[model samples]
Target: MRHYDLVILGTGSGNMLLDEEFDHLRTAIVEPDRFGGTCLNRGCIPSKMFVITADAVEDARSAARLGVHAHVDPVEWKAVRDRIFNHIDPLHDSAVNYRREKGVDVYIDEGHFVAPKVLEVKGEQITADTFVVAVGSRPVVPGTPGLDSVNYHTSDTIMRIDELPASMVVIGGGFIAAEFSHVFSAFGTCVTILQRGPRLLTAEDEQVSARFTELAAQRNRVLLNATVTSVEPHGDGVSVTVACPDGTHVIEAASLLVCVGRRPNTDRLDAAAGGLELDEHGHIVTDSAYRTSVPGVWALGDAVNHFQLKHMANAESRLVRHNILHPEDVRTLTNRVTPHAVFTNPQIASVGLTEQEARRREMDYLVNVRNYAATAYGWALEDTTSFAKILASPADRTILGAHIIGPQAATLIQPLIQAMALGSTVDQVASGVLYIHPALTEVVEQALLAL
Candidate 1:
């Protein structure tokens, strides 16, 4: 049996566990696919790259409205797609090489939990004093009729298309669906989004989701509260049938893309063999310290079934690493107000409570709304979009929540996240020192003032 101090199940956050502090220990990193995992290769980086390019193209096309008379030349699909992959492909190699150089055993095969403290790597039993299962998640394709016969793309494979389809029909109205709708629409494709809910971004605050739905309707076709029946090939394209409250409708497009959601990659690990229990969603059950039911075994990231964002995954990984080493002072993942951002054109970022969430919890709160056009930078950019910066409180103005919409919404929401994480009051956030004038951050300052 091969032995090591640590046996990381997956490569994504697994690599992050290798700290200078752990240099004295022998480590084995097992990853079946490419090294950087989903985020670096297919999920976050590549998708954002496409989103940025789509944004630039859309802006150029809209410039004529401002009398700029600028025109965007045709997007070179091959060149653009290749450029993004070219930059990302190398990082995977570097990560693998760096670990090998550091004397860490890197297994490029699947690792399954065979026994409580044993892992089976490529049919070989390997034992470790401690283990971390960082196996991430993959896009979930709904089991719709005729889905197999037709060519459908998920978040993973959609970005690798040879060229943007002239028109596409997207399934689901979550973040992936909304973001990809914007990207394809901006690229001059006829985009249609079919949502299973009443609005897009169902996971976000209701107000934010409603506003996003309104804004998205301006750029593409959005069908909400619709249930998809099937997808079938029609000539060179495909047609989707959906059943709604009123009746069934047929929508035709050149391509069909599914962005419903993701499922944790725990099945392949045979977690049951390790005595680790999983929830209904197939995610491993873990305590705050990222520990499983069995001793010496832990799970983090998407496998834990908590927050699936990359930042959250990395944070959980760090916490797991510390707890495993110390074991004395175990830290919980609670109390940290996680922030999320959608890469749509104007972007949407939020942290802490939503307006409805605050009210539901029966917390007395204050809501504030702001417009991008009200700011100088907004005027310079001829902005017409609206954004709300909500500061909720329990009559004491403790700053329970903050949400932002419009340009750079993600960047503007960071300070609010810091405030929430630190339990800073609204007064503290408002009184905090901020640089003056000629900055987009002034929007945050203005919103805080309203609070």
Candidate 2:
């Protein structure tokens, strides 16, 4: 048996802990998968790289509307896939090597707690004075009948396929489904989405969800209120049987991509063995300081957060680091504002409460909506369906929430996120700030001004 001053159970955001400051402490990191975590290996970063290419194709397709007729060539799937992994894999290897060279016991194996403060990895039992669990989540695979028998892909495996699927039947309508749909569809692959809900991005403001669903339906075959009952291997592809509100339908496609959601890896960690409390969803329970039920055991990242966002995990990691180092003077995380964006076509981003939530809570809030068509940039791009929706407190005029859909929606939502983080009012965010004339960001300013 060996012991460590600190042992980070997962290498995702947990990787942030071992720095020059922790040099004096004996540290170790355990990870059976990639070192940089989901975001770097298969989630945010690689998806965006694929999106940029998809966006270029989309731009060319829509270029005729700008009076600049343009054409796009077929996307080389292998080349794109190879180029991405070629870059990302080296970085992952380098991280593993760098940490090992630093005398950190980099265990490239899955580990779980066998007893309080003790973990077992590759037949080795190690105890740590303090443990950090950042092992992220994995894609949720719903038990559709015969699904296990057929070959299907999740967000984890879909990006690395050898060839771009000719036609895909996508199950689920969240950000993951929307993103890959945009990528493959832009690359000339046919896409069909099966959403169990009435709309896509149900978490976003109602207007944004409605607008995105409307736009998405135009680009791909979207079956709303769809329930997938079963899947089976058929021919060279898969056959999906869906029960819709109207009737049941059997759809065949070259590939089946499931993007229902993700569940935390806490189950694999055997969190109970460590005396860690977990929610019903298997997420490690934590306080504002990222401390678990057991003392000396702090957790962060997807395992501890249902948000499952890399940026959010990073924020939690920072807080946990401080709390572990200064146990006597522990400071709780204050900034609770979380912002998220989907990099699909007519990109979507949102932060804070949705109007439905405010209405349900009976909060006194003012709301405004500004369409891209109302701005100079919108006219230049001939954008008609995109808009920004903002909500603010009527009393203090503090920006409560903001949602955007359209070009640069991800980029445009940053200022609103900043305003919320700073607790700034609509006037403070928009009234005094100068926006570049004719820029798309003016759309956000317009929405705030209206509020």
Candidate 3:
């Protein structure tokens, strides 16, 4: 058995946990896939880059509405694909080189836990004094009949396709679905979204979800409360049969993108063999300090968190690194200001509790909603379909949560996140700060004021 002082089972954010402080100790990083993991190779970065192009194309098409006679040339799929991956693929190589140069053992294969604190990688037994399982998650394709026989793409493979589809049928209504649907639809694909849930982005505030669904329907065909019965190969693409309350119908598309959800990669690691406690969904169960049920073993990121966001995983990486070094002085991970955003058309962002959550908890709160049309910037953009909503504790006026769906929604929600993180009240946020006149941030100011 090869032994080391530390072993990190995955390289997503696990790769970020390494530094000079751990140079003295022998360490090993086992990554079955790419060195930089999902976000760098597939998820956030690449998707956003593609989304930017789509957004630009969309703006050019709608430039007439703004009285700007601009035209966009046809997008060469190969150029865009090569441009993004050419930049991204090198970073992964560089990361691997850097880690190896630092005297860290890099195993480019799957690592499975066969015993406590021990993993089997490429027929070699690796044992470490301490282990951090940051294996993350993978795209989960629903178990629909004949799905395996059809050619389909997940978020991982969709962005890297050589050619854009003439039409796409997206399955799911979550962030992945919303973002990809926007990307393809704006890029001129006849996009159709089939969602089992009643609304897209069910995690957001109800009002925001409703508005987003309504707006999304305007751009593409959105079938809510619909479930897929089967997926099979059609002429050159695929056919999807969806069952709704009324009846069943077949939708054909040149491409199918499944964005239903993601499941923790714990199963890939065989964490149970290591005697680690896992939740019902197979995610490692950790305490506030990110310590697993077994001592000397830790897990973080999507392996333990419900928010499968890159920023959240990065935050946990910093905390886990510190806790690993100073086990005696372990600090609890705090997600009090956890915020996430969906990079779709009329982008959405949120921090803290939703209205449904607050009501479920039976908290006495006041809800305030301000449409983008109410702001001067909104008028400039001629945005008639976006808004921001704020929920606050009525007694102290402290903001409980904030949700936004509009241009620059992600950037606009940052100040509100700062307020909630620092315990700033609604009154403080609305009156204390200077919201630039006729700026998009005025929408935030108005929402807070309404609260």
- In the order shown, the candidates' Cα RMSDs to the true structure are 1.6, 1.0, 1.2
lDDT of 2: 0.91
| Per-residue C-alpha lDDT of model 2 across residues 162-246, encoded as one tens digit per residue | 9888999999999999999999999998999999999998888888999899999999999999999989999999999999999
- How does candidate 1 fare on TM-score? 0.96
* Model 1 agreement with the true structure over 1-451: per-residue lDDT tens digits: 9988888988877678887888899988999988878888888888899999998998888887678888887788778899999999988889889988998999998888778888888789999989899899998978899899898999988888997799999998988888889888888889999998998998788878888899899989888899999889999889999998889999999999999889999888888888998999999998778899988888998988557799888888888888988889988888678888999966999887887777788777787877777678777778776575676674666777777778788888888888777777777787777646767777777777887
Q: List the residue pairs that clash in candidate 2.
A: none
Error of 2 at 390 (Å): 0.6
- For all candidates in order, the CA lDDT equals 0.85, 0.91, 0.91
Candidate 2 is scored at a TM of 0.98
Q: Which segments of candidate 3 are over 4 A away from where they belong?
A: none
Clashes of 3: 0
Rank the models by lDDT, top first. Answer: 2, 3, 1
The lowest-lDDT stretch of 10 consecutive residues in candidate 2 is 302-311
lDDT of 3 by residue, 132-210 (tens): 9899899998789999999999998998888889999999999999999998888778999999999999988998999
- Of models 1 and 3, which has the larger lDDT? 3
Our model 3 lands, by Cα RMSD against the true structure, at 1.2
Best by lDDT: 2
